[model samples]
Target: MKRNNWLSLLEGKYRVEIISLCVIIVIWGLLADFVVKELYKLPGPISVFYAFYKVREVIPLDIAVSLLHFSMGLAAGAVVGITIGGLMGWFRVIDRAIDPLIEIVRAIPPIAWIPFAIMWLKLTHYSAGFIVFLGAVFPILVNTYAGFRGVDKVYIDAAKVLGCDKGKDLIKYVAIPHSIPYTAAGTRIAIGIGWMCVVAAEMLGASNAGLGYRLWSRFYLLHMMDRLVAYMIIIGLIALIMDRIFRYFVEGKILKWKKGTVAV
Candidate 1:
């Protein structure tokens, strides 16, 4: 009975959200059929669908550019941020010295760094990657720092008594597991920030590619409204997919020890 109740809650909550989405879709379809049909010929879902279906042919180059930058920037940010964060967290003096500068840099909006990125990297892929790094790095660093700091002292004490203070074994047996939640949270946040910065990062300089560049290009062209909307939807869906993947990986593995929510 207890197991059944938990299963029911998960299904119920998931179904409710799906139903809400369906309701919104139905409302949109109706509005498109009646009001929009009579009005200024705004392309509805059909147009959006068609645009998406045909997008590869319409803007292959631009799509490739956007994906390239997004992937590259995210990868770079994750590597650099985790390395720095782990180091700082593992060491007290280094954390104190670097933490202040990290905070200051993090406080500056990523978009504001566009000028510097462009100037430093000169309208290259690295510029976009740098922008993405700026957006994603802070969340990763902060989460790692928190997690490392939050590790129970008792575990460290035990590790010490067990003759575990020498080499790789110490970090593997002690520090890594203790900070899994922090690392997971930081990775989740970094993914979100990287996605959010995609458009702005791509917008940093002149080129004939990327979602942001394409949006600007299309606005100037004043054609293919549905294509623009399709791009927006695609970006949103990608983010959603990434978030779902993250949750599954984190909760199912890294955070399995956490108590599951109790259903009423």
Candidate 2:
């Protein structure tokens, strides 16, 4: 009975994803080993694995630096974005006064700020964080604004009737709770943009050491295609892991009530 249950669990939960991943790996290995003999373009999985093992000593440091950059920027952006966005949504006058400036700044892509960041911050970890901040802030700000604005008028009225007449009280008890889902969605989008910005910022020499810097060094300085591919894979894996973690915390834990609202 236990063996049957284990088989059922594997088949129901893990079988498709495991099989698909294996198939992709097999196809990639085959193409790189036989069809694509051009080592400069695409190295085989074996070569990449070997390169990964060879560079294992430096990989942890690079990953740590990149994560630091990402974390700092994400925290800063979320704090400022949510505060300002909530205020703007609550106060029509504030929204009108700042809307034009927000739109103007948001129009510019985060990559375009790389030169300015380097100039202002002088090629440090802070510069990389700044770039990530630019990438992440807008999505969070916009979504927060939408979330606050979407709060039901009836809720506000009910709160006021219950002696929660102060704007702060109403917002604290009602607006924030209703906006949790929207805030989560915005945070997810910001995380993806922030990850891309971290790579771009590191590539542009915002930091002395990072996965992006190592990727560039392998490709340009050492001409190690296998190592370059290894770094690329590492970046993708890190991003995937971050997204999964964020979803698990926000959607699975904090927003458990949402589970009954949607059917999978």
Candidate 3:
């Protein structure tokens, strides 16, 4: 019964996603492959896939390049983000003082900092990772801080009566568990931003290989259709994987007792 309920929850003609994908392919085939090729001249999805297959015969450099930069930026963001956010959320004075500075930078688009990234880190993966970091960091920080700050006062009061009165023990035993949901929510959002930044960063002369690099490189060579489709597929796949990872780990165990809501 539980399994059936779970399946019903998710099964909203989800298989239509494949149908929608094919419909798009057919539309592109007629317009781009048949009509557009007759004019400016370019290969379609089939030929592009064939090229991708041939390219794989040598080595898959692009995948590795993008993943490396993404991992670095994501790790840096996750570590620093959670720590600082948690601290700021925990301490009222610190939150009030530093929040304005965080907000100022947060308003700027991640790509706007590309020129500075190049000047500082040069045209390298570090620069690319910096862009991704900028994209990811704020969401994580905000979510974590919110989570940290939002812990129930009642829980704290109860803990105090239970001899968890010390500051360190209060935070360790009471606050941390209470804020897990917020932390997980923040993490989920941060990863989405990180993936978006990877493409922009890679295109800013930071990498020779990566989905972003390929998207730009392919377009200049008149492979617009392939570039468009590839990025769409890559970003979609990455989001899916990221969400699944968060759901499996965070949702399953992090706040099991507080799944529905926190009762007063």
Candidate-wise lDDT, in order: 0.75, 0.87, 0.76
Runs in model 3 lying further than 4 Å from the true structure: 1-20, 33-44, 57-59, 218-228, 258-264
Worst 10 residues of 3 by lDDT: 51-60
Q: On residues 74-148, what C-alpha lDDT tens digit does candidate 1 reach at each position? A: 788778877788778888998989988998898899989888888898878888878888888888877777767
Pull out the clashing pairs in model 3.
none
Off by over 4 Å in 1: 1-22, 32-42, 59-61, 167-169, 204-207, 219-223, 253-264
lDDT score, candidate 3, position 81: 84
Single out the weakest 10-residue window by summed lDDT for candidate 2: 255-264
Candidate 1: C-alpha RMSD to true structure equals 6.2
Q: How would you order the candidates by lDDT, starting with the best? A: 2, 3, 1
The segments of candidate 2 whose C-alpha lies over 4 angstroms from its true place after superposition are 1-12, 260-264
Better of 2 and 3 by TM-score: 2
Q: Name every residue pair that clashes in candidate 1.
A: none
Backbone clash tally (model 3) = 0
lDDT of 3: 0.76
TM-score of 3: 0.82
For candidate 1, give the lDDT of residue 198.
Answer: 73
